[model samples]
Target: MTIIRTIPENEAVGEVAEIYADDVESLGYVPTHTKAMAMNPAAYGAFQALIRSVAKPLGLRRYELVTLAAARGTRSQHCRLAHGAKSLKLFDEEQLERIARDYTGAGLTDAEVEMMRFAEQVGRDAATMTEADSQRLRDAGFTDQEIVDIAIAASARVYYGSALQALAVDVDTPPTLGEPLRAALVDGL
Candidate 1:
């Protein structure tokens, strides 16, 4: 249960309803985060746009990877589950589980591992970064723009994940989202 109310997709009104409609169009169901963000659709949309902008440079898969790592670093149950389920599109249960358990041994590519580390570092302590950190990303084959995108995605998790966890926002029911994925998300949570 959550202190914050999670407005249902059908019950949403005004701009929030519009966003919920769009979410259903894209994802087949409104996500928990979307329901929570419905408190202010304009700001929520802006944040989504920012995430999209970040993903444009980093790509969706990389963005999801960063999100998973950032969420795990922050111990955001909703995020870990949501992102773990999303990553299922690119990775298998074994892979996602391995990643959730330990990214270093998850058999990810060096580049992906580096990005994961970057996300964790960004979520844990961005203030501790130095030029060498950027250089490491460069060595991992990421352009400066891509690195910035990684930072943005991870930072977004820090912001949104913190709020969601602090408010104890409850995730949506699994029925509409179907099997396996629902199981994955809930179990991962």
Candidate 2:
């Protein structure tokens, strides 16, 4: 059960409602994490901005891969469900299963796999990352700017992951999220 009651879509008002409205129109639904974050307007705004900034440059598919790896590493049910749902729409069922099972085994290109690995390391322990980690990403062809963006994405996941876990948020199993992906999100939770 959720520690705090999430504001339902219909019940939201003012800025929260506006945000939800936009999300619904764009993504076909307001994700549960977004609703939970609406508990604090400033945090919700920051979350939205961070999502846009990190995701827009890479586009949605790669962003979802990075997010899935981060969510898995963080063991954040909320992000797992939410991003898993989005990922389903971007990748085929087989590819989604691969990402959910083990992104490295998912036939990701060498560079993309490296990116996901970097995301996992940063999500699990940002402080432990050393020059070797940076060098590995650099060797994989990720530019300095892309590496910084990946770090920013991982930082955003950490912030949101902690919030979702602290809130004891229930994972939402949207119909569009699909059974396999849903199972993956709730795995070991």
Off by over 4 Å in 2: 5-8, 27-31
RMSD of candidate 2 to true structure, Å: 2.0
Q: Write the per-residue lDDT of candidate 1 for residues 57-144, one digit (tens) a residue.
A: 7777888999988886676767777676667688877777767777888899999999988888887788898888878889999987
Taking all chains together, each candidate's TM-score versus the true structure is 0.85, 0.90
True lDDT of residue 5, candidate 1: 71
Q: TM-score: which candidate is best?
A: 2
Deviation in Å, model 1, residue 63 alpha carbon: 1.0
**Per-residue lDDT of 159 in model 2:** 83
TM-score of 1: 0.85
> What does candidate 2's lDDT look like per residue over 1-189, in tens digits?
677787888788999898899878877887776788888988788877888997888778778877877777788877777777667678887777777877778888888899888888877888888989878889999889788877788778878998878877766666676676678666723
Q: TM-score of predicted model 2?
A: 0.90
Clash tally, candidates in order:
0, 0
The deviation in Å at residue 132 for candidate 1 is 2.4
User: Where does model 1 exceed 4 Å of error?
Assistant: 6-8, 172-189
